[model samples]
Target chain A: MNKYRIVIEPGSENSNYWKDLWNYRGLFYFLAWRDILVRYKQTVIGILWSVLRPLITIVVFTIVFNKLGNFPSDSGAPYAIMVCAGMLPWQFFSSAFSEAANSLIANSNLLTKVYFPRLIVPASTVIVSIIDFLISFVILIGLFFFYHFIPDWRILFLPLFLLLATLTAMGFGLFIAALNVQYRDFRYVIPFIVQFGLYISPIGFSSTIIYNNANIPDYLKFIYALNPMVGVIDGFRWCILGGSSHLHIPQFIASVGISILFLFIGIWYFRKMEKSFADVI
Target chain B: MRNPIITVENISKSYILKHQNNERYTALRDVITNTAKSIFTKQTIINNSKEEFWALKDISFEINQGDRVGIIGRNGAGKSTLLKVLSRIVAPTKGRITIDGRIASLLEVGTGFHPELSGRENIFLNGSILGMSKKEIKNKFDEIVDFSGVEKFLDTPVKRYSSGMYVRLAFAVAAHLEPEILIVDEVLAVGDAEFQKKCLGKMKDVSSEGRTVLFVSHNMGAISALCSTSIILNKGKIEFNGSVDKAVKIYHNIQTTNKNQVYTSQGINKEIFISETYLKNSENENTLAFSHDEPVYVVIKFYANILLDDLLLSISVSDFEDRKIFSSEVLISKVLSVDKKFGEAILEIPSVFLIPNDYKLNVGIHIPNLQVFDFIENICSFSIVDNGSEFSKYVGTDIGCVFSQSKWAII
Candidate 1:
């Protein structure tokens, strides 16, 4: 008798999930590349859309917040450079979330007809979004040269912030994607969440604006820092602008903790609901 | 002499179906009212009115290393659900299935192909979906394209290929990406007859190489030709698990007996009514038994109170599970010849084409020209059974369905 048995037990989630995913790594790459090709194909502007999207947002934010609201920029650094830094990570998170939320529903044909790791669907969407992030990062570098801003040694922490943003985006993306499969109303809710989230996160202004305005209570500021994006945006500006807006240890810890929490909850909720995806989708 | 390669123990799957008629909201107001009601009274809070159905109930079977197994059943009999569980696409509500070797399934043709991607790219994409490594897919790329006969269209996106070309390519990719066990579910029905034959030959070759094959199809001819052993599924349970010939016989017998009954239904608006429908042999009497060369007639009797225009009568011949094998439709004005007070339509099917196995007839009435009448769906069914004939010579006893009569000369 063969020692290894591939048994499918109903109503029981497989314990060896990591092994199964490792085996399906090829599918992950296929889906990711497929997404990349489909998005770029037949478009007049082609890959420029990736850069143009974030650059346009940076322009709108720079005008509205810096000129109208009189928000402070990182000391001596141009407002465009400061906003572009925040927009890069924020665009990565929002695009990843939107695409991941719709991944399973969009691939209903593949899910119902074939068997591979269901996680590969959402995971591949995140990877596709990462490709878009790399494309848009080039635009960020151009803005850095135009503004003549030089980064400090703290810029070494950029990779940590990128990882933090990716994890946070994936966590939320998995949760919403799983929910959208069941409720379908999540499709409508996602755009609103992305739009609403843009205002709350420090994209156009530095966190110092909120702190210098003393009308807000101290405890409220502490709770506001718990939003996770607060720490991420502040950290990006500190690292890129080369200023005293150093990494705040407590807020960074809170952001990392919340990201991990969301990741665990997302995976659990996704696995629980995955069984019904084929039937309903 | 070999140990079993696949073992299934008491596997069962149940599905919950939410009734569409019941409208319950999960809104805050509704939740609050329901909570208040539950707090005030000693009663269950939620309504458990949705129906639960067991798709597979306590089914168990085993297949040896080199065995070719066929699963046959009527629609809703859980054949596809069983395959889904076996492929690990969906988990069963209960029971377990264990297989020793790598299993590749072609549950549906072109399962992972992107319409925008060229056939060449899709081959690699689909190969990976079937669990082939990149190097393995590269090695077999030429053979896959040759077998599918889509080498010229390899650079064209699959969406541009004709449906026949699409299925041929999809099946070719699946067949060449060799796995220890192969599971195919009724995919052969999509392609032309010659491609289907090639697919059947490939499946036979695979089984002969000491690999296991699990096939689910309504085509009894294909099943009998390829499978050494067969199982009959009836309403989510295994009815018979034995030699291919015996299981096919049981399946045909069940279909024949069930199709002999007449069907009729009445509605408030009596624009049309289904009176009687049945299947009969050439003797012009309703019977389940049929001869090899005899004509199988589908007789339908219907009534229309007012003078009807553009009324269409359609008939389909399907296997036990309602998968359409062949269908035809006739307009009333074209076939009626004269306006009649009452109507009877008969569809004749010539034999020698359908392999000897159980078959069902589905009758439909529609008003394609008028657009005013409610389309009557498959209103009735009947069966055909084949008598002993020489057409069965090339076929083994295990083979089911029609054996095409073709002559071969040593040229």
Candidate 2:
């Protein structure tokens, strides 16, 4: 029996938007759980796909980069293990961005019929991706044992960077999701972006390849960090490669700054577009 | 008047309808071509190709704390748009509204029901979608299960359930919501007769509990039975707002003038098409209003592109609620041989054997009563008034259909 006076005027923004989001947190939780459950509900292998998907990427990257392209691993770490660490964050980002971008259109029925904070749809989609990230974390541990290369104290900083990566994905995701509702051409653009992202990110090879390679220039390295995934992949490798790998400070700071910037811009753009979702979607 | 629970002030909603384009989504290539074309041409192609449509226009009303207000309107009359604005699913383009207490809307049954989820899981899911918390759902969980009568398959996926069971379960969960202001649309039309009755009874129970209810339905019978006051919309404007009887009366007379009398079968088979239809009384005056017991003629002027064989025409009359009250003969009609392509058929009634009410005509063409060639439903309507006949004098309770003669015996 929560009682409050509600006033609706044309072009009036709900001042209690953030508060209402908290009130509808139960819906957010339920929607995320529903998506996760429905995702694997009919599949025979069930949750195994979460693990197998990432594992396949790890093997493909290891062969293509280490064996074929003659890429070096971080010191004593096996190439596969190094690739797994980088693949985890990259996979989480790409999937989170792609799924979040499609979330509003995918739930068009709910958008048209019900009223809640429209932010919950894209936010819940990101949570489903986070669930996938947690499931794939299991394979990362098994990879560690197979290579017998234990991460050091730097691994304790993993949670901090993981939050950063989530924010980066979610920020860009909100912006893209807003645009997708108005123009479905983003549907075709999304897969191409995700595919192009995989090559630019240091998922298969090490970020230090740009650092040590004599042919690459220093200024280009700064531009490389602008990709955001460069710093995250490098940070993941630093934590897993332990004392042998060095985390670059200037690049890491730039990634964090850009992620925060995008997060704010994403929130602003998403809020502006959220009001028109029912009309356009 | 002093303590109204909901107050709406001059609300209007408009939408811009864009012209149809091959590419609905603007790609980079489209943007480039459009820009180059604009540079070469004098006028830009963005603004002129759109048309503004008003779905709701300057609608204002108020509801007392316990008023069970019914919004009765035809399709495209802004009923759904008003509901959406009340539910805050979409914002109005103009005006203001003030609402006291929590408002919950059942716009559609099973709004968020996932087919992959179990019935038990979907209950909780749908409950939260209707703005119920987990603790609230837990408290009513057993009541919902008992009401739905799907305990035997609670753990099974809802996709496996029949459409009846799915809607039943969904309605059961939504019925448990305890929000103080309830907004319900035409959701009861989905379930079967008994379930629909049950839902109506439940809605009555909810209204009697002192909650303000806003109900929207096209069923005039249900509206008159449940709601005392009604709001009628016509062409995005409120035509009437008063007692349920008056609103239903206005709605019954609203359809005939707006619908087409001359239906064309374009892009359809042209073997036979009815070009025109009208009514003529014994006085030979063509009109839609008639007096009881007067002889009436329904004229159908048709054109045949080719020789149509075994052509049969059937006509039926239905009351305001769309119930078929009376119809012409169901048997195959006598085949008529016409020498000309254009001919007219007339079904003459000796006397208007109908109750004093408004009724719609449904005309159809068939081949020897086997296959229907062309059919039009509720194409036109007319009102029959009592003209001081003995048939209209006996008014105790014999108002089904009028017959000129009847025998009554008193022993």
Candidate 3:
């Protein structure tokens, strides 16, 4: 009974927010489960689309950059394998970021009707993206077998990079989702970010191309690392290609710092705007 | 005495009603242009379009355990805003509410139901959205399915379901929620009449189990049948809060007084017009309120500029919710053979015919099936008080709109 006692006042929810999140964990899982189930319901290919999207993209990148353009593969691993490794995290980040950004408006009915942690909506969308990430990861395993390339002990550190990518996606996702509720203009902004981020971040090609090329200045590389996906993709390549792939410690730290910083900023802005979501949305 | 399970203190909510050319949402382009205009023209454009409207103002109330409280109000009278504040869907602009025990609010049926999800899946999903634990939903799964009567199509997606089946399935999940307090909006308005009755009965059972229930509905019959106490809200303030009978009576009075008792066609030019209309008693005195056992007369005076054949005058008596009780139609030629240029039509509704409630009249002059000369909706308003009739004793049970004097014998 004491656990159930609730005091509701203007902005009084801040004190019980995390506890509410913990209590509504069931709703969190159910929403994620519902989205996953519904996503594949009507389509014939269904879940296989997750795998096909990244596999096809990586194949095109390999042909365009490696076979046709004669670009050097800095990692020394097969260009297809290197591209596949980076593509997995990039796909996960883009899909997760976009889906989480629009999740609040998509579930506006629930926003106005029920009392739960509003964070659950965007958080659940990230989980859906994680499922897609896992499905596409299957392609990476297939690439490994086709090339007969064994990843070294560094491969075990892959979960650490995945966690970093999740944080980066969530930070941006939560920020835009809350802004979308208030300004609705952010809805158009999200797809643009995804499309632009895909090109700016190192996914189809390697980050080493920019670092090793003398024509590109040092400050330019620093600005490029500011895009958190640069670090995430580079980290994935390092884990899969082992010691041969250069993990630039300075750029890596810069990216990690930015990811954590965005996470805090996103959460701060989201919490500030969450209480008014029902009214404005 | 048991302590009150819920205590609200001077709660108020105000919204900034932005007059943005009727757009429901503000666009960034508008904001940017407004900012640019302000900078260039040296005038603030945003403040002129903003006005603050208080949906609720300084409302205070307390409810003891096991109380069934009904909230009654006209449209936009802050009823929904109050519910949203109490349910924590939206925070009040000021003040506090302290509540004991687990509280669940069903502001709408099928709130989070996915159209493509199976009925079985929706039940689980909806149960959690309503604040039930997964295990709790699992335990009540069978009962929900059985109550909804959708056992044969449990695996079928709800998009394929008939609307009746969908509402039932959604309501079944809500009904099985075992919260200490339940707040329900006008969800009972859906489904068929028999299902509505069942929902009222189920709510009564929940109240009997020592759980608190707060209901908002336009159906006065449902409110009287289920709620033990009631609150009447008028323009964001509490007008009255006490026994259900008194609250309902106050609501009835509020409706009639808000409109005109005597209706007249002021500035309209028509072929036929109802010049004046009013309700009168036996002594030929005009009145807007009546007891259940008193005969009432609706007098309508009309003048026809051009005499024509096939003129039918209809007087429809409907409740505040616009549910028509009955409409009486009279063909002018069949009833009277006098001059058709000027006439008066009087409708006598006998004693014991109407139940105790507020009602309005819609007077229309039209051809039998062709055209309408004049149709005035809510031409006048009237009320029939309880008068301590036999139906008054069954106040917390469904007392239908019409009264019957038929005799019954025990077998």
Candidate 4:
């Protein structure tokens, strides 16, 4: 007889949890596909909303921060393109974070009824966020053509920061999603976090502007690098804006460190809270 | 000896039931403030505390391959909790469990079905949710659609399908799940009777293939019909574990004994409440089972905290099907008043004219037609068996709610 053993004990982590997650990869596919398919089933502008949102946000930020506030772009960068570059990562992070955060409650039926890894639900939500990111990235290509600006070889390094941005969003998403399962008021707190993050994350303006300023203290600039998105947005600007917004090596390494930290902590917290999800969700 | 397919060793589940007044949906704001306050005062003062309830208490059982076991119990008797623990939906609070094969459970039909998805898409979706790989589902795709009899509308979203069609499709996907062990809850109750029969037959086929099955249901007939062995659960403990017949009998015995004295304090007005209600034989001794000829008395005890008048006592009898046979007051024309403010009142039936069947009692206290003071519906139920009376001797004559004794002549 071909025997597979499963032993369940109180307060003991299943040794096969990661293996089981791999085994249930099919469930992950279906759940993500279902969310994407059902997301705009009845809407007229379905997938277009993905690009429409970032386009509108980019326009608004360019007008308000560059034209109205008279903030100068990096020496070689266009104001609109700089904001668009930053908006790409910011939109991905915010959308992915909120989607994963709400995933458990949205699929509470599946959570309570089935035995697949609860991580699959939020992970799939993050996948949907990635899809939206890809769609919105198309708008950035259009902006490049409108400005007759061809990005330099630094664009090749874009994937690294994109990965960083994804990990950072996923890490925080996992943390918030697990917390949302217990304290539902996070639903109200997410918008506040996203909105508050918009101003602090160097999205509408350039981080190089902060780096180039002589009046600001060096310690304050170092503290600003603590935001994981600082490196991500700086990377986006460096690649798409050419050499205008240079990557600060020290701050970039710090941001990468923080992203990895968030990734590890998020997974730790999620797995710790996962066992009780069905009981309390 | 072959290894058992499943073994549960002293598994228990305890649930913290929050009070209705407390917000069941906990918010982060409250948790944060509460923590901050507790930190400042070095004290924890919960405004509305919660109670811990043991849904399952040290339940242990083992099932060998091909053993079709049924779990019988009353509502909230931990039957569902046991299945959930075994399915890994909820972790056991204590003890351990061991299994030797792939187990697929359907705690509810259409568990992960999205009404917005088409039937064909949902088929694959449901199958994958139940642990079937994409390739496995693809292989069984035709069979599943065929069994559900929904091939014609496979492309249509399930929300448009009739409820029966939805249930049939859901059950077909679930029933098609091929696992070494199958665990099913009372989800069978969702399908129609014909679909239910088909499901039972399908389960039998699976067991005949040397697969183990654990079925939980309140339907005694279904339990005894499908399972060779069964366990009875009462108040989170296994009361009996033996043959299906004996286990079901013990279950019924438990229910009858446990439900004999039913009391309800949930009423519109707490001024007068039905504190206790029970069954009694002609000798005025309490009993749950009665004879055909023996007079049965409904012993009612009530308590009034404040002075009351024009208090009416009434009872309405219903057959096993919950059809109200008749309802009458103590006296139709005269308004009945409480003689004793707090005491027992015996309403005697000189001779039970009812056929041999179960009957439910609905008691009420009212002030004539002005308003109802207290009313408890289906508070208690009792069974009457045939005692070889001329009318009772006609076996299978439990056709009506009330038994009427009348003289019949040749003319």
Instruction: Report the C-alpha lDDT of model 4 over A85-151, residue by residue, as the tens digit.
Output: 9999999999988898889999999888889888899898888888988899988889889988788
Task: Tell me chain A's TM-score in each of the predictions.
Answer: 0.95, 0.96, 0.97, 0.96
In candidate 4, how many Å is residue A89 off?
1.1
lDDT of each: 0.79, 0.82, 0.88, 0.83
Q: Which stretches of candidate 3 lie over 4 Å from their true place?
A: B258-353, B356-381, B385-402, B408-411
Ranking by lDDT: 3, 4, 2, 1
What does candidate 4's lDDT look like per residue over B1-411, in tens digits? 877888899998999886633766777676778779888988875444668899999899889988999998888899888988898988999999999999999899998899999999999899999999889889999989889999999999999999999999999999888899999998767666567778777877888888888999765556666788998898999989998755754565576876746564543558777778887776666666666567878877776665555566788878778888777665321322355556666777656677666788998877786977678888668866544344432233345566666667896
lDDT of 4: 0.83
Candidate DockQ scores, in order: 0.31, 0.41, 0.57, 0.47
Error of 2 at B216 (Å): 1.0
**Which pairs in model 3 have colliding backbones?**
none
Name the best candidate (by lDDT).
3
Summed over model 2, clashes come to 0
Better of 2 and 3 by DockQ: 3
Task: For candidate 3, write residues A1-281 as lDDT tens digits.
Answer: 45778888897646878988998999999999999999999899999999999999999999998999887775588889888888999999999999999999999999999988899999999999999998898898898899998889999999999999999999999999998988889999999999999899887788888988899999999999888999999999999888578798899999999999999999999998888999999
Q: Against the true structure, what is each candidate's TM-score?
A: 0.79, 0.80, 0.84, 0.79
RMSD after Cα superposition, model 3: 8.1
Question: In model 2 chain A, where is the ten-residue run with the lowest total lDDT?
Answer: A1-10
